[model samples]
Target chain A: MQQPIAILDSGVGGLTVAKEVMRQLPREKIIYFGDTARTPYGPRPAQEVIRFTQEIVDYLLKFSPKMIVIACNTATAFALETIRSRVSIPVIGVVHPGARAAINRTQSGYIGVIGTEGTVNSGAYEQALKQLSPHVDVVSVACPRFVPLVERGNFRSEETYNTVNESLAGLRSTRIDTLILGCTHYPFLAETISDVMGGQIALISSAEETARDISTILHDKGKLARGDLLPVHQFCCSGDPQMFKMIAQQWLNEQIELTPIVWQVPHIG
Target chain B: MQQPIAILDSGVGGLTVAKEVMRQLPREKIIYFGDTARTPYGPRPAQEVIRFTQEIVDYLLKFSPKMIVIACNTATAFALETIRSRVSIPVIGVVHPGARAAINRTQSGYIGVIGTEGTVNSGAYEQALKQLSPHVDVVSVACPRFVPLVERGNFRSEETYNTVNESLAGLRSTRIDTLILGCTHYPFLAETISDVMGGQIALISSAEETARDISTILHDKGKLARGDLLPVHQFCCSGDPQMFKMIAQQWLNEQIELTPIVWQVPHIG
Candidate 1:
């Protein structure tokens, strides 16, 4: 039996990553958890977000996954290192892959990043970029409003476009040749974001880049699943099973086995 | 006291990878070996190519590099596993990175690969692609003439264009939406190859992708150089030093420290 790659997110945003992982590594099994009971870990305190992420990881660990992907930018910003120390298996975060890709794509040395408030406040992307190349200039913004829209499945609406346009107005003026969609939820609104940013600025999707990194790391370790048999994937959510199922199916374009977990953190919601 | 990344190729072809590693990971130092005395490893027998690559790896090991990059496609196709087993450090190759990039870019599932006779005959790219996804259709062609042109320092002449155009005619006719510049030497001729293949096909350069992989692997290992000092790189070749120095400076757009090594292999050249 192939050990699954476990993925966890604050909400539906991580479906973007799951979709790409499936597309890129078709043979690998996946087990995903969404903390919809307390969605939008973006605006929460760092400690709270880290605690929630640890809980989800602990729950996912029951299946003995080969790798854990922190698909949420906010959680990756706050909780990646702590989780890395706690887990023996390889744990990947979305931030560095996005940052590395932005560094690769940017010709002007100026990069723009848009993420959740928590992630922006953490300055993860900036740290990751400058750590790799000190000469890079980073511009970061917090888009606290975008995640709710994505969670509600309000993609492509006029409100979505207007919000995206107004939110990115400051970034549009910069001479940034590359923009990193620093949040996993951001890719759901990529068309709107692309329309606002125009054709010149290359948008780096953390979801796509993270999946590619997963492939690279797994291939290096000789852990990639080699069997030809199709692997079954499992999806779990902490709240509102119907809404989670609806959005996940529409986003993933397939039916998923979703198990709705009772909220274990009683004080949060 | 920084441990440099050791990159070796059959000739100056590996300079493509070296230049990218410099651009993307500016903080890291590099020690590069180009076996120019007996280059064009494409037409050689697999065992001979393996022995030559092992020799280069043994020579490069003297630098105590943190990682070994088999930057030539033919050498990677023939000798990566052997080198990896022989060396305790991480061993990276050009093929898998290019294959991964091609897989990421190809929407039509039809991919084209052009390399020297050895890489094409080894079927490494097809195997890598199909191993990841069983559905991709691969079109492989061996361009036996492109390497000598690059080695001779002839990049943008009309003769170069005609040679590139003629060599890729069969590939241009295919439905491939992505083409892998399978040989590290191929990127020097990218503009002409792009012109021949047109804009519809996305070109995947192994050099750039390999550099990105190097970053990913190094970051994961917690061994990325942290100092702010400007890294001085060293380049060595086993053949004509003048032509090698001229081409290296021209392609890298910077003056490089070059050393000429007396040819150690008496039987080949």
Candidate 2:
């Protein structure tokens, strides 16, 4: 049996990453977990977010995956290092990949980042960017409203356009040549964001960049899956199965096997 | 002492990769080698190219670099696996990175590759791309004359434009949406190539993509350089140091320390 790449998120935001992985590495199997019952870890305290992420990772680890991807920006911000220390396999976070890509794409040395409250508060993008190239200038904003908009599947609605336009108004005044969609959920509203940001500023999707990093790291380790047969993928969600299935099917454009998990400990959910 | 990333090429082509590494990972040190004495490994036999690459690897090993980058497409096509097996360090090649980037950029399944005689003949890009995504349609062309023009530092001459236009006349007929600049030297003539191919096709630079992979792989291994100290890079060439220095400074946009190598054995040079 081929070992799968396990991915986890606060909620369906990670589906953005999962979709890219499916497109980029079609042969690799995936086991994904979305804690939709406790969705939007953005406003939660760092410790709580870490605990929630740990619970999801523990659930995903049962499959003995080759690699673990922390696909949500908030979870990656709070729990990535904690999980990295505990896991034996490679644990990738969304923040650094997005930061590296922004550094690669930015021409003015000025980069703008929009993420959840937790990710922006943790200053992960800023730290990651400065760590890679110290001279880079980073502008970060927390979009607390964006996640709820994405969770409801209101991607290109007029409400989304208004929210995106107003949210990015501060950035437009700045001279940033590249804007990193620091939150995975942000990609869901990318078209609206692009319409507001216009053509001059390039948007860097963390989901797409994370998938590219996954390819690079896997290829480097000589661990990329190989075979003519396509591997079947499995997904799990801790929430309303109907809504998760609807959103996932629409976004992935394919049928997927989803296993809804009931929390054994009622206190967590 | 910060261990440098050792990069080698048949000639000045590898400087493109080195320049990107400098821009993306400013803290990391680099030691580069150019076998200008026996330049243009494109038309050489596979065995001869492998032997020359192995020699450069043996020479570079003395520095105990953190990683080795075979920055020439011809050498990467011929000798990457041979060098990887011999060395314990992470060995990066230009071929896979370019292929990966092309896979990421191509909206259309059809991809174009232009390389030297050896790289194109070896079918390395086709193999890499097909290995990653089996459905991609690859159109490969061997541009044997492009390298000599670059080596002579004849970048934008009228003669260069005609040569580039005539060489890529065949590719213009294809419906490929993405073209991989399979040769590292090709980026030097990117303007002419882009002018010929037009904006509909995206040009994937192996040099830039290789640097991105270097960053990803190094970060994954927890080997990225830290602290604010700028790294001083070193360069060496087997042939005319004057010409090499001139091209290196002009391309890199900074003064670099160059050491001319005198071959101990007459057979190699």
Candidate 3:
């Protein structure tokens, strides 16, 4: 059996990425890890996020993944470059692909980005966008409540709608024709967010682009799983395996056994 | 010195992909080969095309490219998977990325594809689109005159306009909202083609997408050129180096040396 593509995230938000991966690359198996015990990596310092990401990657390397996807926007913002340097296998992150998609989709050259505070504040999307399109304007805002609402699975509530509307109110005045749902969790609330932004605005989700990037890299590297063998997929989390399992089953419509991960937290001085 | 990204095409058509690669990844040093001696590999037998592509790829391997880009649609249609398996470095092709971009841009699920006979007949775009979005309808047309016009540098004449309009006449009735310029040579005819298809239709060129894929692969492989040193880009042709040099200088607005390749034509039994 081929080594599964490994994915890690702060929590269930990355299940958005995982879902797309399963949909797009059905022949390939996945091994996912969610740091649910340390959910909301948005509020953490960059250094801590890097350390946590490194720990998760170290654990994933043991499984011998053909590639690793940093599915967390916050962790990707802080740790992608570092983890890529440390790993031999291909490592992918959501931010650059998201920015590239947004750059491609935007007509007015006015692009808006919304993510966790860590992702927005980190200016990763802005840097990526500028790198792709030098003159385009990048407007980023932090939807601080969106991830929490998704984590609690309160995506369709009126409360979620109101929070989305209130959080995105500042963008209505700007001529931003393309909005990047920069956080993986935000696509779960795509309907409410789309309603707030109106039909003219294009919403760029990194999940699909990231999945496509994975396929390109795999095909290029000759790492694509060959033959029609029944493949096995794994799901694990550092905290609350049951919650992750429930979400995985619901999203994937398959019963998956999830193992709880308990890595020794290294003391970071 | 960083290993150059190697790009091969049947003729100057792949110059389009090379131009975009130079634009998008300025730090990248590119080694390009145009098989001008066998300019139109379109309509040729698949095995012959593959043999010709392998010959060119064998020539490129001497440069130690960090990656190989099959910049010609016909070559990619005929030989990408074969070359990929034979090489250890990343081998990228234009068709898949072009298909991906078309899938992303087509809102009506009705996509039009225009390419050389080999590319159109290969049904590579249709397969790629169906793999990504199983329901989308793909309409492909072969424009035999277009490549010769580009080769002859006849991009803006009234005859060229009439040729593009007549060539794409069949697509006007298909209600296809997105068009994939499947051949790398087609983008040079973008203005005339866009005018023929009208302003509403989105044209997808594999050049920029292929370039992005290169950048993504390089970054993932940890082989992206590190220093800010001025990169030396090489251009070579199996046919007329002088004509290729003139076009290259005009298109890129930079003086460049064109090397004429003389490979012992392998005896095909």
Docking class of 3: acceptable
Per-prediction DockQ comes to 0.79, 0.79, 0.26
DockQ for the candidate 1 complex? Answer: 0.79
Per-residue lDDT over B1-269 for candidate 3, one digit per residue giving the tens place of the 0 to 100 score: 58899999988888888888766666678999888878888889999999999998888898998889999999999899899889988898999888777765667889999999999999998877775555588999999899999888888899999999999999999989999999999998999999999999999999878887887777666676655665888888877767777777777789987753444434311
Better of 1 and 3 by lDDT: 1
Name the better of 2 and 3 by lDDT: 2
Fnat values, one per model, are 0.60, 0.66, 0.23
Which model, 1 or 2, shows the larger lDDT? Answer: 1
Q: CAPRI verdict on model 1?
A: medium
Isolated chain A TM-score, each model: 0.97, 0.97, 0.95
DockQ of model 2, rounded to 2 decimals: 0.79
| List of clashing residue pairs for candidate 1 | none
**Per-residue alpha-carbon lDDT of candidate 1 for residues A115-192, written as tens digits (9 for 90 to 100):** 999999999999999999999999999998899999999999999999998999999889999999999999999999
* Poorly placed runs, candidate 2 (over 4 Å): A260-268, B261-267
Question: Model 1, which residues run further than 4 Å from truth?
Answer: A260-269, B260-269
